[model samples]
Target: MIKATHRPKHSSIPLLALLLCGLGILALGTGAVRMSPAEVVQALLGPHDETQARILYELRLPRILVGALCGALFAASGAILQGVVRNPLASPDIVGVAAGAGLAAVVNLMLLPNTPAWLLPVGASAGALAAFGLVYVLARQSGEVLPIRLALIGVAVEASLDGLRRLILVRADDSIAQALIFLSGTVYGADWERLFRVLPFAAVLIPITLLLHRRLDVLSFGDETAKSLGMRLEPARLVALALAAGLAAVAVMGVGILGFVGLIAPHAARLLVGPRFGLLLPASMLLGALLVVAADALGRGLIPPIEIPAGLLTTLVGAPYFLYLMRKTGRVR
Candidate 1:
């Protein structure tokens, strides 16, 4: 009985890891031109044939890696924020981080067309941090970050930032299509260059987030409890919020507004593995990665040559689930 009880607690990590590997393989193997699993492995491991090498290395591999990284970033960010605010609905996109990043990226594209592409991510991170800080300042009352207030203020801020994003996009005569496609959240043209662009930011943010699980757990137990246990509430919260904002910003800068992964991955991870942030963090990352890979694969396969964006697919799937979550939480009002 004791062993059985402990088994479920630890099983989720390995299971999620396995799921992520399978999804990664699936994402690589199935596209406009399908490769068998053997071909996928051979391409990954061995002497590179030109055709297989081009398909795997040039196109599919980078997209798959970027999808996985973006998913991990968003999921980890959401998990951190949800734990910090003690709200199931809190996510980067819902809370204005994505919108802020989007606004900054749009502005960057509009104003400095000649700027190195790398600076876009930096601008996005700055915007996301600024937006989150603004929301926190507006939402906090009596030194407490209340759930409803935060969510409402986040939505309001998101709406306002979204307007600015549109304003920038509208002024762009030459780059409008590019901006719209990006806003719709397509990893359509992802290549090694884009992969390298996002890798550094996500590479740094994700490991740091996983390391913060203990602090997140302490914060999740309410400010009074955290203080009683000698955890500094404000500083801890700041670090958690900053980590989340940066993670989400990097994801947005990479993938162009993945709306659902951040919100759904954490909830799904908690359901699968329980709310222990240590397990929860990694599990959420894997789950989010799997979600995006699967969505990308399905989107590519669903309509043949005309591919749907993974972001749009996720939104379609996530909206109803979001409603269900709200209903369950009894806070839809």
Candidate 2:
């Protein structure tokens, strides 16, 4: 009986590792022109035929890398926010963070036509900060912020900004098609340069999160308990929120709003690994990366010659799962 109990625990790590490797192989192999797993492995290791080399290096690698980064960032951000609020439903997308970044990018494209590509992410970060600031101010009461109120305020703000974005698109002189595609969240145009732009922020933020993992775990308890445990409640909350927001903003700026990834991935990881943030965060990142990569592969391969947006595929899969979770949690307000 003891051995049976230990067997599952002992096997989980290897199982997870195997799953990740399989997903990575599948991601590399299942793109537009299907490549065998052996071909994919060969392409990565050394020079292949010119066509295979170009496809592997120029096309698939960037998309896979960016997809992984975006997924991991979103999942980490979601894990942080959910921990902060102690609510399973609290994700960056649901809290106006992605909308804020999206609105900023849209405005920059429409109003500041001459702005450099690099500055677009800067604008996105600024907009995300502004939205969070607004939510913080509006949700504060007697020097304490309520999580539920913050979420509600975020929903309202996101709705308002989304309306404004549509209005801007309607009146703009240029084609709204590109903007629409972007808003749906895709890595179709991701290249090395854009990947490089997002990598630094992810590098910085993810490590900081790992360092603060213990504090996050503590904060998951009720506020009073966390304070009694020597956590400075407001300051810690603010710092976590900042990290989560920055991660979300950078992700949105890099590849429009990918919904449900942040929420679903973290929650799923929590179920698999338990509630300790130290384990949960990294697990969430890995699972999140896997999900997005797999979804991207599905989007590219589902129809011959035609592609669906990764965001749409995620929404179709994620929304129903989210609803099921909400029902299970009985936390609907």
lDDT against the true structure, each candidate: 0.82, 0.80
RMSD of each candidate relative to the true structure: 3.1, 3.5
* Candidate 2 residue-wise lDDT, 215-261, digit = tens: 99888877888889888888788788878888888787677788799
Sliding window of 10 residues with minimal summed lDDT for model 1: 1-10
Off by over 4 Å in 1: 1-8, 46-49, 114-118, 140-144, 168-174, 331-333
Highest lDDT: which candidate? Answer: 1
Clashes of 1: 0
Write model 1 residue lDDT over 1-333, tens digit each, in one string. 112332346787898889788878877888788888888898889976789889888888889888889888999999988888788878876567977877777777777776575676677767887888888888878877665677789899989998977776676776544544665677788888888888888878887887887889889887788889898777788788878888888887678778689999999988887777889999889988888888889889777787999999899888998999999999555
Model 1, 96: alpha-carbon shift in Å?
A: 1.6
* Per-model TM-score versus the true fold: 0.90, 0.91
TM-score of 1: 0.90
